[model samples]
Target: MSKIYVLDTNVLLQDPHSIFSFEDNEVVIPAVVLEEVDSKKRYMDEIGRNARHVSKLIDRLRETGRLHERIPLENGGVLRIELNHRSFHQLQEIFVEKTNDNRILAVAKNLSLEEQTKENGRAVILVSKDTLVRVKADALGLQAEDFLSDRVVEVDHIYTGELTLYLNTDLLNRFYEKGELSLSELANHPFYPNQFIVMKDALGTSSSAIGIVDHIGKKVKKLVFNHDHIWGIRPRNAQQSMAFELLLRDDIPLVTLIGKAGTGKTLLALAAGLLQTEDLGKFKKLLVARPIVPVGKDLGYLPGEKQEKLRPWMQPIFDNLEYLFNTKKPGELDAILAGMGSIEVEALTYIRGRSIPEQYIIIDEAQNLTKHEVKTILTRVGDRSKIVLMGDPEQIDHPYLDEYNNGLTYVLEKFKDQKIAGHIKLVKGERSGLAQLAADIL
Candidate 1:
């Protein structure tokens, strides 16, 4: 028998196409969900943007049949808007506030009970992203599930973007003796293009050989820039070494770094980019930017030039630069960047329709972006340019995003085995002792 799947507002917001995900099952959209979607539809940010998209999708579906009643979906499923269960009286005994969650729970409970009375009763499952809502459904003996459509992979099993394949003794000797190896030999090596290689002996010993290469037999030489030590920075861990490999590779064109806070993700990318563009003459400029997601407020009404308006959100990028330059004066680093016309930091909002070439682009805080948004950004990359995307999956601020569903995770999961990409998950917190402890305990 086909089951009845009730969708929560968060699930719909996270993925507008979720209504069709149940295949041959019946999909129920509570009337209260439409209210929440309407309120969020006015937003100009990603969440609001997704809300409006969902609204439009549903409206288009209505053209095929009646949505308030039962509408036959093309995928052998029925979609319906349930206004009959708008009352919260059924759940008032347990939840006194009559909150929106309580009303949704009441609908699920009523549906399950009504189905149980019929022959070949359908199973009613409530799908939500909210933890509390799931807990409430379980207490009431109704089936509940988290919408897993967006999760690319399990949290612990997520791709690190870097994989080291152990080579035979002879292969290692040949690489060291000849300074290169054939690409066909690494067919089963489980490495992405631009992936850093640390050739270690299976017997266990030595610092291990470190090198980076492209998929088509081109070697990316290590960067030779002198470190200023202005940011009080160091590699801190092996993952950073891998990150540096991708950062210096001009042929890689695309790089992604994943880690928690204070692992030096953005700092390392910025430093390597500066070395490549300013010191090595490999690229024309170094540009950094991220999506402007306010922690709590919307930025649509903020008034100023693009740079001034973005300053508040992009301050973290500046902080890294200030520390890297080690300038005592406030405007000293700005003058340096202005003199070279080599460094530009802007917002991702206006990146569309722009053809950027021969520059190193670093997109920070990328985990807050959706897969669609990330695709939009990557498609704009011009020739001879490299783009690095870095983010901490645990530190997402997007309302509808989780670890498995965000753009950073999507890229890492989808492009893990492909060439022209490299990834690293930095496990250590190098910011400070206290920062490390906080990342562990808190």
Candidate 2:
């Protein structure tokens, strides 16, 4: 049955392409939503970017036919703008004000009443990324939903880059003897390119082997860096071992690490970055950057210029570097940074419009970015440059992003099949026993 999906301003701001996601269902955009979009169109953030894109899309749609009247969409659907002639009269007094949200709710309520009594008995759903808006919509007797087009996969089901294979003792023996196994050896299990595996004796023997699926998915080869250390920091767990392999490989230019707190995601990347830039000279520079997203209501404002202001925000990176440098006294790490002259730390805000070549770039807290933002950052990489994106998708600071829809998850899912990119999800925490317990229960 066809349904009427009312678009909310947050939905459009979260994703400009959400209008086309409802398939053949009729989409209704509340007039107040456009007003809200207009108000935010001039800002210089992700929301503003999406708002402007939505405006352009609306302008293009206007060429086809009048948007006020019903217009045909390419996906066998119709779209139209809605305005309640009754306006605030139908709104509840409890709502108090005729705010944009209430106005949009009123439009949705008006449509809900109209669609219920239609000859075809269609359904009306309010689509918004705002939790309060969705809740308010429900109170007003309208079905509400979150815009989910960007959520390519569920968080729990995400590809973790490593999987355990319970092979028969004979297969394990064959693998150990031959040093490789064909893809057909495990007929029931399939794997992605570069996916790591822990082959265990299915018969409960202590025998096990660790290997990685080749780029062509033809065979599994033993890990080359199983016992190697990167800048004196070794992998503490199997997942971290997998992460180090991906980070150290020069072939895989793009790598993503997803894990909970204390999983050593950023530490492994930084260690590898240091190894490649300082020791191997594989890259000309080591650049580390992260988005300046605040955890709570922001401190409002901070003093000092960009580099100075970034100190607190980049302190986590600094902490890892200090640990690697084994520095005790103050200014010691500063002296090292000054002496190296090849390490650069900056905010993601300034990374645009710049070509970064022959550099080992690490983008921390990638879960706070959008798919478009990641694409922009990746395009800036020049020849011989490698980018490592590390983040715990479950701990995103961006209000509009979640584990499944953030840029980290997006890239990890989209590039799973590509040979040039590799991903791993670290489950075990290595920070401290207390930290791991708190991460699980808290």
Candidate 3:
């Protein structure tokens, strides 16, 4: 039997097309949700954009018939706006407040009760991205679920972009001798383009060799830039070496790096960008940008001009650049940036509608971005440009996004098969022993 799904405001704010996700079911939108969405439609962020998109979608649907009545959808589902069930008395003993959450709960509780009385009733499930709302719904004996349509993969099963293969001693010797091995010579495995591989001795020996899948997907080739130092920075770990292989290659235009705190993701990306743009002159300029999401409580409005206001958010990028430049003074790095004329650091907000050509672009803290936001950033890439997106998925600050649904993981999963894309998940922390311990235990 078809079930009934009542959506929360956060669901639509996270994804505007969630209304059609419930196939062959009845979708209910509480009137309060529309009110909340309307209030957010005027802002200038991802949430605001989603709110406007939702409003336009619902308005387009209204052309067919009244939203208060059942309107057929293209996915064999029916949608309606619930106008009644705003009575607070039903939940007055437990939840006395007249908040929007309570109003939505009241509607869901009434619908669930009404369904229980019918001879053949459909299940009423409240879908929300808010954990507290789902908890309250459960306390009131209503079925509650999370909006899970946006998740690209489960947290534990996410791709690590590296695989270990135990090979026979003869095959390993042959790979070392020839500097490359055909995929047909190895066991049948699902290997993606530019994926790192560690071939070890299967006979319980200590010998091993590292290789990466060629873009053609038919051969595993030796690392080319493993021995080169990029901008006076060297890869400290095997994964870092794999990352450098992807970053230095001109053939691969898209690279994604994911790791925990202090895993050298940002530092390595900046080093590679500086080397390619300033040293090798491979691109016209090096552009570094990041989303401006604050950690914990926000500081409200910042002071000074655009650059000054952006300093705090972009300080991490500057720190990495300072290390690469060996600068000691406070304003020395800024002077260098101004003198270079080939390097630019800015926020991602102003990147929309701009076509970036022949540049090395790095987007840090990409885990805070939504899928649509990342798509917009990627579409801005012009001819002969390379874009690197690096972030710690476990350290997201966006209220509406989680590790599995964030833009970083979304791109890693979606582009793992493409020849022009490469990904690496750094596991070892090369910053300090204390930082590694904190990352592990804390």
Candidate 4:
């Protein structure tokens, strides 16, 4: 049976193409949702862009037929703008506020009641990204669900970029002696290009070896820079070693590093950027950027010039740079960056529409970006340019994103099968004992 889905304002803002997601079902957009979307269309951020996109989509649909009435969608679904069910009598006692959320709930509740009287009643489900809205919907005895069409993988099942295999002692020893093994030796298991593998003895012995699948997915090769340090930073764990292998390789232009707090993701990327751009001269410059999403209550309207205003937001990047450069004085780091004239640090907002060729780009805190935003950033990559997107998926600050659907995880899963990309999930926190304990338990 075809069901009826009521879309919340956040659903459309999260994904403008959500209208076409429900196939062969009826999608209802309460009138108040339009108002909320209109309110957000004026801002200069991702949310504003999404809101405007939604408005344009709805406007284009309006040209075909009246939105207030049932309109046929391209995907065999029915779309309608519900305007008559705004009455809040049923929710007046429980939810007194005439806010847009309550108004949306009223529409869903009324539709549920109206459908139940018919012999063939379709189920009414309220779809939203807000957890509190779903909770309040359940309190009102309405069927509510999270908008899950954007999720690439479940949080528990997210790819860790590494796999463990138990091999016979002979095969393990052969792999170590030759420094590489053909894909035919590992035919029993499937592997993606550049995926890290830990080969252990099948007989429960202490023998083990670590290697990465080649770019063609046909061989397991030893790490090239497993021993060498980059920019005075060495890999402290197996995962960090794997990250270096990916970061230093010019053939693989895209790399993603996912980890919790203090996993050395940003540090590793910056170190590799410095090594490649400054020491090796492979790239012309090193460009580091991050999305501007505040954690807690934002300190509204920071006072200063452009760089001064950005200093607070970009301080984390500066801290990593300071450690790498060993700058002790207050203005020493700024002088070093200026003197080098090869490293550039800026926000992600100013990166659009620029052709960045022969540059090493690192986007820190990438999990705060949405799918569209990430795509925009990736499309900016020019010839001979490498981009590394590193972030902690669990530490997202974007209101509409989560661990499963954030830009970092989305890219990790989408490029897992490709040859030009590599991913590593750092498990250990090398910052300090206290930071690791907090990341584990807190």
Candidate 5:
């Protein structure tokens, strides 16, 4: 049976192509939702861009037939603009305000009632990204759902980019002696190219061999980087060791680091970038950037130039650099940065439309970016350049993005199988004992 889905403004803003995802179901866009979308069409942000795209999409659909009345969709469904908004009296008592959300709820309630009165009627569902809106819809006796088209995978089930398997005690010794083990000998234990593997002794002893899968060789070879220090920063854990091997490899151009705040994701990236750029001269510059989304309340406006205004936002990057630079005085790190001149701190806004060539680009807090934004950043990479994305999915600041839908997680899932990409989910927090407690308990 066909269903009617009343889309919320957030749903439209989250995905401009959501209307066509219903698959033969009726799609209704409430007038109040359009009002809200129009209000946001001038934002100059991702939401504004999406709002305009949605309007253009709707207007283009008008060419086929009238939207106010039911029109045939390319899919087997019908699209309609719900201009007949019922009175707010039904919602006024419950919400006590004529807000856009309230009006949207009112529309869904009215549509539900009308559908109930119709014989052989379909279900009326309100799809939204706002949790409160869905809760209110449930209170008002309406079916509500979250938009799930872009969600690739759940947080807990995200790919780890590594695998551990028990092997015969002799295989570990052979791997250690010969420096590699054939994948065919593992008997169908599947592994992706560049995937990290730990072959433990079958006796469950402490003996093991750590290597990465080489698909060309049909074997898992010893890691090129083994507990080595990059720019004075060494891996503190097994996961970090795995990450370092991927980061230092010239074959893999894309690496993703997923971890919580104190997991050294950004620090390790900065270290490798510094080593590759300043020491090895592999890349021309080390460029670091992150999304500018505010965490809690906005500070309104700051008083300064672009770089000065970015100081607070980029302080985390500076802190990691300072620790690496071992800067003790107030201006020591600044002097070091000025002398090197190879490190460039930038905003994600400026990264668009520019092709960055021969640079080691590290995008931190990548979980705050959309999939489209990720594509834009990746395409900016020129020849001989490498891009590393690092973020903790749980610490996302983007309003519409979540662990499963954010750019960082999206990249991890999409590129896990690719030979040119490697990812590591850092599980240990190295900031401090207290910080680890906070990450685990708080």
Candidate 6:
């Protein structure tokens, strides 16, 4: 049976092509949605960029027919602008504030009633990215759904980067004897590429052998890069060990790290980058950049150069660099930074036009970015460049982002199965006991 999906403004802002996501279903766009998009199009951020993209898509669709009238789509569905929905009259009774949310609810409620009496008896659903809007729909006895096209992974089913599989002692013996074993000898199991493996005896007789398998689970490889310390830092967990392996692997150009505050996401990546570029001589330079999204109010119009204005937002990066350099005196780190012309710390604002090659790029606070911004960064990777994106989805400062829809999650979802990328989620907080307890209990 066909369904009618009414899109809310947040849905489009979250994903510009959300209109086409309901591919074969009839999509309804309330006039209020356009108004909201228009209001956001002038901002100089990801939301504004997506709003403009949505407007362009809608404008292109106008060539087929007027947006106010239902038009046939190539997918045998319809796109419509619901200007005559009757729920506006009913909403005035309860919500007299004339807010955007109230207007959207009114349209949704009226559409649900209209679709019930249609010739084909289609079901009407209000599709929103907002939790409160869905609650309002449920209160009105209407079917509602969250815009789920952006979700990275199913709840409770996220990637763990570790796998345990049972193998006979003989097989383990052969693996140890031969220094390698084919994946065909192992039993079938769901294993992601470069996933760390703990091969247990299954009889509980001895310590389990730890190893890593290729994405296809074909070849088991031992962890050989046993550095006592990475640039004077140590791996906090097994997941970080796996992340370090992935980061050092030249074949894999992409790496992602996720964790809450104080989990050492930025510290680990920066240390690895420093080791790779300055110590290992793999890359030519160490480049670090992150988006500018203040936690609270925006700091408008500072009188300074680019780096000075960005100093407040990029101080966290500087703090990590200072620790990695191990400088004792004040301004000692600045003296080192001045000498290392190869190291560049800039904002994402100026990264669009240049092509970076032979560099170790670290993008911190990636959760504040959008899917488009992330793409722009990735697309700028020239040959022999390794890029690491690290951020906590829970700490996003972008207004339109959440745990499920941030760019970091989006990259993890999109490129997880590929061989060139690796991801890890750091669960335990290593900053302090109180911080970890708060992360768990509060």
Best by lDDT: 3
The C-alpha stretches of model 1 lying farther than 4 A from their native spots are 164-171, 180-190, 211-236, 294-309
Q: lDDT of each prediction vs. the true structure?
A: 0.82, 0.89, 0.93, 0.93, 0.89, 0.83
Q: How does residue 261 of candidate 3 score in lDDT?
A: 94
List the candidate numbers ranked by TM-score, top first. 3, 4, 5, 2, 6, 1
Candidate 4 lDDT, 1-442, residue by residue in tens? 9999999999999999999999999999999999999999999999999999999999999998999998999999989999999999889999988989999999999999999999999999999999999999999999999988889995578888899988898899899899999878876778999999898999999999899898788899987775476788988998998899899998899999999999999999999999999999999999999988888999999887889988999999999999999989999999999999999889998988988999999999999999888999999999999999999988988989999999999999999989999999999999999999999998
Per candidate, the number of residue pairs that clash is 1, 0, 0, 0, 0, 2
Q: Mark the regions of model 6 whose C-alpha exceeds 4 Å error after superposition.
A: 116-121, 215-217
| Number of backbone clashes in candidate 2 | 0
Candidates 1 and 6, the one with greater TM-score: 6
Question: Ten-residue segment with the worst summed lDDT in candidate 4?
Answer: 222-231
Q: What TM-score would each prediction reach against the true structure?
A: 0.88, 0.96, 0.98, 0.98, 0.97, 0.92
TM-score: model 2 vs. ground truth: 0.96
lDDT of 6 by residue, 1-442 (tens): 8788999999998888777778788999988999999999998877788899999988999999988888888777889987876356877776677788888888888877776787777888999978988988888888999888777765746565667778888888887877667777776766666667768886777846667776665788787678469988898777677778777888779988888887888888888888889888999999999998888888788879877888888899999899889989998988899998778898999999889999999999999888888999999999999999988887887767878778888897788778788777777788789998887777
Worst 10 contiguous positions by lDDT, candidate 6: 153-162
lDDT of 5 by residue, 180-238 (tens): 88888865866788888878888979998788888563889999876576778888988
What lDDT would candidate 3 get against the real structure? 0.93
Across residues 1-442, which tens digit of lDDT does each residue of candidate 2 receive? 8888988888888888888888898999988888889999998999899999999999999999998998899988888987553377668675879888888888888777777787888888988888999999888878998887879794468888988889999889888998899978776677889998899999898999888899998899887675476788988988888888898898899999988999998889899999889999999999999999989878767799877889988999999999999999998998999999999998999989999999999999999999999999999999999999989888988878888999988999999999898988999999999999999999
Q: What is the C-alpha RMSD, rounded to one decimal, of candidate 2?
A: 1.5
Candidate 5 wrong stretches, greater than 4 Å: 187-189, 215-217
TM-score of 4: 0.98
Which residue runs does candidate 3 get wrong by more than 4 Å?
A: none
Of the candidates numbered 1 and 2, which has the greater lDDT value?
2
Error of 4 at 98 (Å): 0.8
